[model samples]
Target: MRRVVFLVQPQVYLLDLAGPAEVFHTARDFGLPYELSYVADEPEIITAELLPVRCATTWPALGANDIIIVPGKQCATLEDVNPSERALSMLRAHHRQGGMVVSVCAATEALGRAGLLDGRRCATHHQLQDELAARYPAAEVVRDVLYTVDGNLATSAGIASGIDLTLHLIATWHGPTTAGRIARALVVYARRNGSDEQVSALLRHRSHLSDLVHRLQDVIDERYTEPLRLAELSRKFGCSERTITRRFRDATGLTPLRYQQALRLERAEHLIASGTTVEAAARAVGFSDSRTLRALRAAGRTAAAVAS
Candidate 1:
């Protein structure tokens, strides 16, 4: 059986712990064998957001070839949480030894504190956007997105976003069709994509950084409605065009043009899902016309169909 360990902590959000657990437990229906367990730094009764639950064993006692999930806690102060020390250590060690480590919401901060997020791209609750960015300057913090998977580390935003992240894992492990079936059985309309904003309107908070790169991101964020050109941005920054291109590519994987298009498409998708007319979405995202929009939509549909 594939093993899944939930490293439960004090004040852990019940849904964050349960949502992914339900997905892994239901793996049998998708023809995957899974053994799920709840673990902590010590084997004892612990109180979560809900009624007190007993942790069956210490993390060290768990076996291998499985997954470990760190659920979000209500508290933001991770440095003072002693319950996280052993659990975090185990999670890092497990991940280093090739185990999948999942962190939801504020729990992503624990992974950062444990040094697991160094040089990794991740997402977390937008409320902690500044905290995570300032705390781990080396880590790339993506706000608004539902989840991000950097190699073995998987992270999600706050609260119900855990459901989306968990269902994504199911799709990765089994297949999209199986995951869709499970979502239907569970009565969820669809699994939120990784790019979906889990913390809508909460990403206004940003880290205090002198990096001109942030200004670049801001320009893209605001001027997504306007035409974006790498040469124009380079001229604006007053540096060599090569320096601008290098810094922008280093900070974000895409060229400035591609990144702006991605943002526009993301907004377009949000409109489509929210009952907005396709034409409205096209105009809102600054597409030249509906011909390009329809083509993009068709391409996206084909990609999703292929993935499924």
Candidate 2:
């Protein structure tokens, strides 16, 4: 079992702790062995929202595969946040032992205090990016990213982004399919990547509340690499093809086929970035040939340029 321990601090941001925790907790429902626990210097602390939270006073024995997450707290400045010396030492020792250390939002200040951010790429809340960089000059503070993972250290921009970061970690350990399922369970429209500064194609144009379109998007998300027919989808969803098509377009501003292609294209770009050949990436995403992929890529670039 992989133990995920949350290092809860005083004045903790509830969402920063709860969001990632829920992702791990939800993954257990899918047969992933994630053991959740919380630890803090005191047995009880109050949250930033003025809510009481109880936790274990003692830290658990962790192995290389274990994970420790430091949830962010409310503080006027990075210097105003003070973690116990023992906690800072524990953070350092955990990293030295090859265990993963994660920070959400301003809690990255704690990791920086522990000297873990030195010479590593890290991210924190946009408001603290400058302060983090100034304080930890040796660390490469990445801006405009949801999160950054360098070796065993992972830091997120905080708040809801913590959920995105945890989902990404789940995807890394398990697989994209498993992560996708969890996202669907959470009703998250899409899993944004660490590199995305804006909404992803999978997330864009998904603001409408049509249940049928949402369900159709979920199916396409899972089967984007396979041959999917609108007729088959219509029969499965008990709707006519024309109705499905019109509703999908009305809800997402794109036809179902276009939505599937967008997913395929997004994944193909990632594969190509990782050194896959154009033809191989196209084939991997269910394109009949590289020519279609190339044309789509060119069109996307032109559209982006026009938008800019």
Tell me how far the alpha carbon of residue 67 in candidate 1 is from the true structure, in angstroms, after superposition: 0.7
Residue by residue across 170-217, what tens digits does model 1's lDDT show? 766654445655665565654678885332110221222437766776
Q: For residues 75-114, could you state the per-residue lDDT of candidate 2 as single tens digits?
A: 8899967899999999999999999999999999999999
- lDDT for model 2, please: 0.90
Error of 1 at 154 (Å): 0.3
- TM-scores of all predicted structures: 0.62, 0.86
lDDT (0-100) at residue 219 of candidate 1?
75
Error in Å for residue 77 of model 2: 2.0
Stretches of candidate 2 off by over 4 Å are 174-181, 187-197, 200-202, 273-280
Collision count of model 1? 0
